[model samples]
Target chain A: MPQIGGAPSGDGLQAVAMAIRILEYLAEQRGGIGVTALARALGTTKSRVHRHLRTLVETGYIVQSPESEKYRVGSRLVTLGRTVAENFDLSALAREEMRALRDTLGQSVVISRVEVTGAVVLATLPGREAIEIAVKPGSILPPHCTAQGKLGLAHAEPAVRERVLLSRLDMRTPHTITSPTVLREELARILERGWAVAPSESLLGVNALAAPIFEGGGGMVGAIAILGSIQFIEAEPSALQIRHLRQAAARISAQLGDVGRDGVDSLPR
Target chain B: MPQIGGAPSGDGLQAVAMAIRILEYLAEQRGGIGVTALARALGTTKSRVHRHLRTLVETGYIVQSPESEKYRVGSRLVTLGRTVAENFDLSALAREEMRALRDTLGQSVVISRVEVTGAVVLATLPGREAIEIAVKPGSILPPHCTAQGKLGLAHAEPAVRERVLLSRLDMRTPHTITSPTVLREELARILERGWAVAPSESLLGVNALAAPIFEGGGGMVGAIAILGSIQFIEAEPSALQIRHLRQAAARISAQLGDVGRDGVDSLPR
Candidate 1:
């Protein structure tokens, strides 16, 4: 393997550095990026940028717009990202369970995983014959406010939780919890109860319930969440649905080889 | 911004070259790459590779798998890749219509676009119920056997189609049309009817119907495909569903600013 971003010692290392710089610049830009603008942003000559762009193009890591002479990242990168997601296998394992949950709860069901930096929605199965909520795969939501985010944070290691608490948390809605103390308390409660709920926190008029999915190593690898419009979610008479959600999560966790704490070690593969 | 592959005149270009070399090596592997293996593969020192890997990690373009200590592409790259996909926006415009088709036909629906080298599935909506046949987003199917592939080839330039015809087309299933003459005739029929079908051609017991999504500039940007198990699709004997699929494709193409027989002036804002 060639060095990715080390100091320019050789041609290979230099190429990798340039590619990283180019990707970083493109990531910062919300709209499409042009060659000249990218070159300017990196403080490099346009001709040089063009060559790197060509290499990125051939590799399907980046694409050039036919309408505008701009370059953007390509779908191949998404395929690669999905490979990281494959290890979790939450989608495949929970596909039927997610569908069953959505059918039973009549809400959007989402499976989310804790990544190195943030939480990402791995899969979403919308409710039957309902107003659809488009939760595309790869959509990232902040851990402090979302139900799955809270569940994941509640189950994360202390050091990881502390880091999250200290990091800047974006408030997507007015009801979003911004204070670290409040979030910490909420996470603790969620951990104790083995479930979490967020009512119009991340997005107005959307309520969500989530429970953690544990990996074989006793780590919370992901969460199964059910989301619905506040009107629908709140209209339920009792917390029975919440209980059901927890049961569903537990079943999924069991499927993932999480036998209760007492029997987990003795369970056969 | 930086030169990626070509020989650089200075240190900056040298860095770009190194990155490209590393990327090329990774591309060849088609699997997660280890630092030591990559170092040997690139004939570079491990420390140098480690440094470059660190830089790639910092940029969020590549991630080190905790399980294997091997490097794979990262989700950030997928975020950037999705930006490029958003730039295309053909799928975004067609999403609603695809949903409608899925509802109407009760089949998995796919929207695909042609790239310079191959065709890529831009978006896919699973059927109303759990179906065995589900084409994933970013799944690249062969251009010769799939219904969408045939639609794409039918509308492509004659010379391009000829080139494809000359190449060997792998038979994915026993029913796949591998004969060049048969494929050419099928392509002709597709061009004439503006639609194509594959009855258990790509996969056993799976069938697909596709129609080209063409722009006003006479460019066939993509296709709308409805796929299902042969049993269900054959049960509904109606050209109306096929027309609906074609009409949906046309609506999407129009949304891409296609005005039939006139050049694509501008996409719908």
Candidate 2:
């Protein structure tokens, strides 16, 4: 028999798990899901799923169609999501800075944050030209591969970094950094140099440079990166552009209340 | 005593409600919330809240600082929200058409959708000039006070439109369509004319014109609108710009699989 609230039995704890599972399933489906389908997917009885559905509907986390009785993720979640996205102070502070970077460097600029599980693209400003690389906001990049991920890992606490290294790093490209020892050493070098670079590491022919943004409390809040075609970024002398990106990252860090001395020594050679 | 899981008494159901309550509380708090504060706000026992917190942590819906034990909404939600925002066909179709309209009329473009509880701005493209009025994506607007809202209501199902009329109409400015009867009549005219216009409806001296984006099925998905200072929109000969806006809206509607040839005769005078 399945564990029905045995060791997991607590004050409404099971309900919370069910709700999250329901939301996750809805999120995965994208389209609205019917009650029966949801129940089958969750491996629960229809009555149990129906009870949870009613709660979700009443709470505005999911909406039930009047005609079809299908349930979809609700608009309240969108409102809540907006609030959370805006909570990353780095996004707000980097907005104008990223725009300037795009204008100056003529390349797409993206700001990303490292959460416990992975790295999420927070904001992206496309380059002025129509043919530039586009990294849509909200795209998740593997923590062991992308430039932003390396930058984030470089700044993460030692324990957290080790845990991440221990996890499987699914290689996305032929050039992706896969070995944990190599990745660990690369992260160390990133920390020492104050920036990270991914040359065709995440996607082939896409070059990216990233620097970490620190909060006032000294924790790395996120990373600011500039991305473009290898042909463009490599062919052009990018010392000035790299300096501008670093300066912009520093400004964002300052806005997050990071008042550290200018760490010019951190820029990757 | 509160009605604790009055209708849905299953353990899983209750757990879902508690987790939603916790998220709602965190959203309101903006900054990371402590377990004690969340429990007090949610009017539940600390131990119960802690259990929910642990579940959220495991599911990646939330994360707590190792040092502080303070919890914040997780990046998983951000990734999910981005998917929703991007996959919103209405917004995607509107963005390209809005860019075209902005280029043609040199006015800011906005696409809005009516949510269950409120109106949401889904996408926005600012005009080339600094004199234009711009709405940011994810901004909320009152239904009875914006042109996009009026267009949405004009094209909504009869029952929903009636409910909106029965609801309170928040008066944002003197020009807001506040009276239910008058607003209903206005919607009728807009339906007849195939478009809607609001002169200083939500903001003083800001004029807006919008057309609905019809889905393949009969229902309206969203509305695309152009906003400008009254003096600017009126100063130009409006027939050409209005024609362009209608054509742009039609293009987006067609992209959404709206094959109806009812034409621009449905616009309001």
Candidate 3:
């Protein structure tokens, strides 16, 4: 085992990065992906990607389909991901709250960690309906587009907010707020109201309402949101939806040892 | 991106392997691990492991505790693992079957992918009882010492069986069959009876009975098992338990296009 010194030959680190990227891309794809397509997506050559894929296949991180000769994520890797999520205190604690929210609202509930880039979904419970809005856990919701994302951005640190403002905000839908000034103003409104809503922004007909979850030190660590079709989770959310969403967020934050009041105490009983 | 030629410098591949191993190890540990402990576990120096840990932490694959300086799996990696598992058809398809088995037997039901080494759990459903036998998905069962593992071995290819026979069988408990000759006889019996049980073998007070699941072309792809306390899932299982387990396995196999019968067709109602 030679030392991986900080030299160009230290491409060992690069290989590790490339392997993870490949697994991420495969995880996102519902269908199997070929070496060529993966190489293109990764901005690397076919052979390089091929070698990495081969190693991943051999290690049981990704499995190559016998019929299609394409690769997909393997069960071993899935187990690894699940184990990580299961071990996290945030996800474990939030799930019971999320289930309760789902039961009361009959709509899908999501809990997301507020990251610099956006809100990363940690857990989700599906709505109790024939037609439900379901977001995959581990998917990122962009800062400019989603209710969770917007609430996360509004509560995020100044530097994090500046980063999102400086970066290009790709329009997910026609309703997505791309202007930094407008988003800044929207963030102010969310702060004042103690909740956030993104109607037909991230997707054409989907809408969500979010409230912030704080940790012990009064830091907004995450958000709890309810999502559905615009028809259900309207542009102006129903009184019951807002009430339960705020209560759920507050409950989770309290369990995490946060004593901060996000105006939940002021809400009409 | 330099082409990693097959020299010792190709430790790029080694780095990738090391990163994955670290993740797998972290996923297993409930508490955060220190750099020294991880290095010791990997049989490497602290510095080498530290560098890998830094890369992982930077990439959100692992996180280091600011208070304790110990490391644990991060949410991003959990999401990746879950995404991979959700993308797999086997886990999705078998979940419904596992739920049904749990309903019928009131014992925890597990579905595992049969590998040369053992059975790797893909999905599991908790039993209806207050004291349930719950096995985590993604954990591996040893071929010589568990019900699912034995059923997998009984139906595996000859080369695979030989490989297991040649490997050292560690004694998990007093009842675990460490002798290859004894295990060989047990495998033959499982083949004849079309089911397998490991009572007080893997764990002292637990037992499991398993039947094989097959994919197209009559190949054994996995197994479905009902596990509980030894009091419930006895060494000599009830006829109802055997019947339901076999039926569930057959139903899943049929869905996968496997038409072969392991005496399932001849079982009395």
Candidate with maximal TM-score: 2
Q: What is the TM-score of chain B in candidate 3?
A: 0.66
Instruction: Give the top-scoring candidate (DockQ).
Output: 3
Q: TM-score of the candidate numbered 2?
A: 0.46
lDDT of 2 by residue, B1-269 (tens): 32224563543356666777777666545556788888888788999888787777666667554434577765556656655654454675467677778888888888887654445888888877766578878887666777777877776668778898999898888888789999999889888877777888888888888777764434566777788888766523278767877877777655544455776534321
Write the candidate numbers in order of decreasing TM-score: 2, 3, 1
Who is ahead in DockQ, 1 or 3? 3
Worst 10 residues of 2 chain B by lDDT: B1-10
Q: DockQ for each of the predicted structures, in order?
A: 0.10, 0.13, 0.17
* Per-residue alpha-carbon lDDT of candidate 3 for residues B1-269, written as tens digits (9 for 90 to 100): 33323545533477788888888899877767899999999898898888787777656676665445677776566556656545556767677778877887899888888766689998888889898678888899999999999998998768769888879999999999999999999999999998999999989999999999865445677899998999998899999999899988887766554555566655322
Residue A216's lDDT within candidate 1 is 35
Question: In model 2, which regions exceed 4 Å deviation?
Answer: A1-12, A90-195, A198-221, A224-269, B1-12, B88-146, B149-196, B199-221, B224-269
Better of 2 and 3 by DockQ: 3
Which residue runs does candidate 1 get wrong by more than 4 Å?
A: A1-15, A27-31, A42-45, A65-67, A87-149, A152-269, B1-33, B41-48, B62-75, B82-88, B91-195, B198-221, B224-269
Q: For residues B65-139, could you state the per-residue lDDT of candidate 1 as single tens digits?
A: 444467754434434444444455667768899888888888889988875455698888888766458888888
lDDT of 1 by residue, A1-269 (tens): 43334435443345566777786666545445878888898889999888787766655456555445567654455444443444435677688888777778788889888754657989888776447865789898778888888887887668779999989987889999999999998888887777778888888988888878764335566788887888767623247667667667766666644544632222222
lDDT of 3 by residue, A37-148 (tens): 9899989999999988777765666665454567766656655665665565677767888888889889888888876668999888888989767989889988888988
Name the regions of candidate 3 deviating beyond 4 angstroms: A1-12, A90-269, B1-12, B90-269
